[model samples]
Target: MKQLLLEIDETTEAKINAAAKTAGLSAQQWLQQIIDEKTVTTWPNAIKALAGTWQDAPFSEELRAAEGQDISREDF
Candidate 1:
């Protein structure tokens, strides 16, 4: 594990400490958990989830034709 100092404003530090206590964790542990959750949520997992869900949806020919028209207009 790496240890480093963080300089935060007093209000931000107080909020983090309070949240850590509410969750029954040390401030460092709580911060680490938040970072891990954010990393996972913002990664390719989100894109894969969207793609999987959209795969089963019915095809829309009208939507496809509209998209083609939009693409052609942007080519000019």
Candidate 2:
């Protein structure tokens, strides 16, 4: 694990401590959670769990596929 050093005013530190205490987490854990949430790039577990649960879900090609000839475009 990497370590970080931050400089904060006493008031900010106090606020962080109070919020972390209310959340039942150490300051480090609370900050880590916030960082993780902000950095997420993919679906969270709750959303990923929904995969394969829908029946007859349309695939991308099925939705975008066109069957007829293209319509003519007028002169620009």
CA deviation > 4 Å runs, candidate 2: 49-76
- In angstroms, how far off is 25's CA in candidate 1? 0.6
Residue-level lDDT of model 1, residues 1-76, one tens digit each, is: 7889989999999999999999999999999999988887454665667765655655798558656554345555
Each model's lDDT comes to 0.82, 0.91
**Which parts of model 1 are misplaced by more than 4 Å?**
41-76
lDDT of 2 by residue, 8-60 (tens): 99999999999999999999999998899999999989999998898987897
Best by TM-score: 2
Tell me the lDDT of model 1 at 69. Answer: 52
TM-score per candidate: 0.52, 0.58
